[model samples]
Target: MKINIPNPMFKIRAAAAILKAAVIPSNLRFPGRALVFLDMVRAATSEMAADVGNGTKSDVLMTPVTWLQDAIIEAPIVALDPEGDPIEGSELIALLETPNPFYSLEVLLAGTTLSLAIDGNAYWIVNHGRGGEKLPAEILYAPHMNMEPEWPANDPKKFITHYEYATKGQPQLIRPFGIDADDENAGVPGNVEKGLSVIHFRKGIDPDNIRKGLSPLKGLLREIWTDDAAASFTAALLKNSGVPGVVISPTDSEVNMTPEEGDAAKAKIETQFGGTNRGKPIVMLGPTKVEQFGFSPAQMDLSALRNVSEERVTAALHIHAAVVGFGAGLQSSKVGATMESMVRQSWYSGVIPLQKIIAGEVTRTLAPALGAASAEFDNKGVQALRENEDLKAARIGRLYRDGVLTRADARSALNFETVDADNVYLSNLATTFIPQGQAAPPPSNGNGADPKGILARLQDPAESLTNLLKAHGFASPAAMLAQLGLVDPGEV
Candidate 1:
């Protein structure tokens, strides 16, 4: 009666166990580095050109995106002191105005920061031109694709950087970070400590890929898939009218054909009548009639489907659809004079944060050298100047009334130059009352005389009335009452 049996729990555990061989291969990862590398290149080269107009005019001009990038780069950003006052004509401001030989301060800062904002990574090579000192003479943009970052001992901050660059007909060479401007051995490696300036910009969540910033467009790959599907649907709209699958017709009903004959007939019909031939007249031979089958995208409204993909792109860019003329329904939402205000508010709100980030980076890097206590970025040309006149006036007036700001501060807030007289503060006065030094005028009576003499100079209005009928509808209150009562019209 003895028998060997496997335990039910053991069998269950064996069935549920994950085998090493069953694990997914590393190569089978859905998205590989190749796609990310490609996107990095695209982001780097996104604003390469601007198109102003048709032909040469347009060719010479920059595109909207490029223009926007340039504006951000070239914007006149001033450095402010600890008191929020601009430090004009300072070395720091000048450095920011023009960072390097090839590019202006605005351009360098804008381009680099934008690159970091959009692509999540940017690099710069600090060149100490002429007599080598700690001060950075020129900051040059280094291509992310060309630079291979190395971390010795797996330290995030400690890294040996080399840039692989080659011109036409020249052998590709690895150039190390921080080569002396005058050094003949600049192209050779081993200059790691001398010139490496690597900024992480924005860190990604994945510790394994800490060197690279998490791209804002990382979600775009999924969006692109939806775009691809939409494009395919559109193409299908042209071919099969959005229908999927083929039409099968029972052979003419009157005549029978072999499989070869049926296939040949189908091919012949397709070549002559499919795609562009759709909606055209069809002439039948004998009793044969053509019939269409299967469901198509056009039948289900292709535009409605495509809008979803368009919205995904809009959301990824974090821009208003109206800015690029993209409407909620395949066209941009209605843009009018009123919408301009909304657009400006949206744009400035987005830009100010980036501006602050850029300013912080610049100040942190250059403040020590420039001998400045602290620095702040001025939004002068951007928001301060562009504010509505009435709104600006109201803001200044409110501040002046509240005594929270001096006259000079109010004027400065309104973008006006300060006057010596405007510098005085009236903080001691009640917020609702005028200041102590300023004299308050006495209260005026209805007559232009002292309030005490008003009763003495009074006169009867009836005595002054020479023309009774012209002056009043009735001569007096008593006369009017008599006409209506017993004293009658005869007495009048």
Candidate 2:
């Protein structure tokens, strides 16, 4: 029985081995001259390294070395030959196993690639990266941010206008979200759909974008977080954010009616780590007198929020963890279509998906990260070439003539298959992907990148493969696309 994974979006095609034979360091000799640039990637020394790629970054909470490397050491492995170090491969195998945990991901660009000689002979492969790790300066956003059912409103999600601090007159006035004043009767706005709630800068010098600023995570956000509506100022002055800085109290968690033990926890904060960074961040959240700032937990449809929260968190952490090598290599090299799924995960990192980040396709952002010294690659000065029509055409033509493509060369290139006028090369692949492309790669079709082309190919994998190589000007888009099918086609 064919399981047509709804949307056919779950295909996992990377397993065919996108990785080519290793480029051993010894074979490619370094020039006599020496050049050194900035030293951003220090040797792995931080205790953070031990727990990185795993959720338990905190030593206090980490129970095991769960990253992909350690996990592989435990997986079953076999020796290929005496030269490749059959026994040694088992030890190095640690680098090949583990589960990916990225909720976000970034690549290692402009850095030294790690290599290992295989079979004690001349074979080699990139085992790890040693530098160039940069997360986008701006946080990648998911299509929608999940909220607790208790969140401010219950309608369609709304966007922000601007974040304002203490406004003219009164205790405070938030422009688009909400406002808060010294008077308790100022009134709190209920959660309204297509609207917002505000967090008044009641204290002073607020620095966050109430809209985008994420706090230092105290270990991935707790699945259940409630902002009590009735909570009052005096109660806060008395106690503080409870251990984990929170009590499971829901509506009672608000500022108004003061739950019995609730106030006790606030007082407890003062009693223990009173008045210091060690104490809570000492922040207050409430309805903006106007629905201009953020959202009010008061109006949320708790049921929907609860469901959304769980689903959103799961989607988010999975994607987020994938992008930044979260559980990559720490577990497995995103086996087969999993890498496809991993790439798709980036779109779920926040409330709005990045225009540049999407699933079932490759994006320009995937371009091989240029090394710090890319300026000198001297590959016909292509690197120095400016972006324009001529450059695009030339590059596309070059790749087409040379038959080089990004679907990654297959371990076994097909033979004698009388290439039809519409000769396709790779059918195993599913793409709109070709990292460095221009005016005429097989997929280019003189129309530049078709981000959604793969979805179109989804209907008939066979026919699409036949017509693929003719895409753009690539010598064989078919081979490129076909190769993408290395892994199973239904799991990505």
Candidate 3:
């Protein structure tokens, strides 16, 4: 029998060939279709009074997305050095504060978070100076819908060769960071000059295409459609003054009308008694009967169905319905501490994880471009991320009082600077003055000059301890007894 092992390089080349030949899925090819579908669903649902919409804000998706964006931007981006310490007066911080003349850090974060929520991907183009500087001059947001990645045909080690940015004008080609633009086989389509590198932040992974991300909304399409239909039904009912669909016909069998006359009568009835004319009276030449044909809103249990749909939508997006103010969550929620807990839950489950992804991408791409070691969001300033001050203070105080923590440690836990005087543990007053391995002094016999007079003064612990030490030829304060070898430090 012969034993044989396959070559690792051969396997790598085979895998690369398979990947290069793999066809991109429709979801990755046209991400804008999903967004358009979401917009349509929102429009259909906006007719209901409970669906929040005003002017440009009509999408129910905006509720959670806006909440997440606001929470993420609350923590400012901080630049870090090689030793993992936050750097002060950094150029990266200045660039982030004013990413470009047109937008601030808040706007940049808002746009990025919005794109990630809708399309599961967000991109930023870092534009360098004309003088070939390493630091970026300006950073511009590129909408995920308009961007497409191009892969190399022959290179097994490379993933994305370049990115194609399609706009109203000519399509621009952008080079990836660390890739030379002058490379002959850059895999760009045209002879156009390529733009700067793009930093991408994505949420969930897409199994169909490794280069693209799958939107969370992809799995909730049915839920959104059901909710939209429910809203449309409610709106239709309200349009008719909460009346169900009805059928109108003559009761008398002998009084038959022509087809044209029936059509005319139907048109007249709708024109006079439908929509804005809902409250108008109906009159007929002959005896007529009207019968409702469909189920009423209460009979269909539409409210419960809509509530379920709302919950599924918020849950799939990693947000609590209570945090989004949906009626479904509000019905079961309380006002004070419960609401605060829900907000904190939303920050932990939704906002913080997304912020980590954005921060990691920035550390990998934007920080290096700006000559920094790494980047992170400074969440210490965020109110939701911070522990309750009252609770934290009580915990530190208890630890200090119990001698589990030194005074300096307690102060440091509360974010205060360390003081040298606070470095020692506090002595327990109950056990500090108790004598150990020593006999009590003899009582005085009414003599003014007796050495035992120090024993009579033992009523006051501090005074007696000091006098006793002085009577033994050591003149020191009771507080300083710990410094001397006469008494154990534990007792003092």
Number of clashes found in candidate 3: 0
Candidate 3 CA-lDDT value: 0.69
Off by over 4 Å in 2: 1-170, 174-314, 317-320, 325-492
Question: Which candidate do you rate higher for lDDT, 2 or 3?
Answer: 3
- Sorted by lDDT (best first), the order is 3, 1, 2
- Position 126, candidate 3: lDDT: 81
For residues 263-305, write the lDDT of model 3, one tens digit per residue: 9988998899887998888777779998877666676568788
For residue 331, what is the lDDT in candidate 2? Answer: 54
lDDT of each candidate versus the true structure: 0.48, 0.27, 0.69
Clash totals, every prediction: 17, 106, 0
lDDT of 1 by residue, 435-462 (tens): 8999765555522334423333345453
Consecutive 10-residue window with the lowest summed lDDT within model 1: 52-61
What pairs collide in candidate 3?
none
Cα lDDT tens digits for candidate 2, 122-168: 10112112221231122111111111112122221222322223324
| TM-score list, all predictions | 0.50, 0.17, 0.67
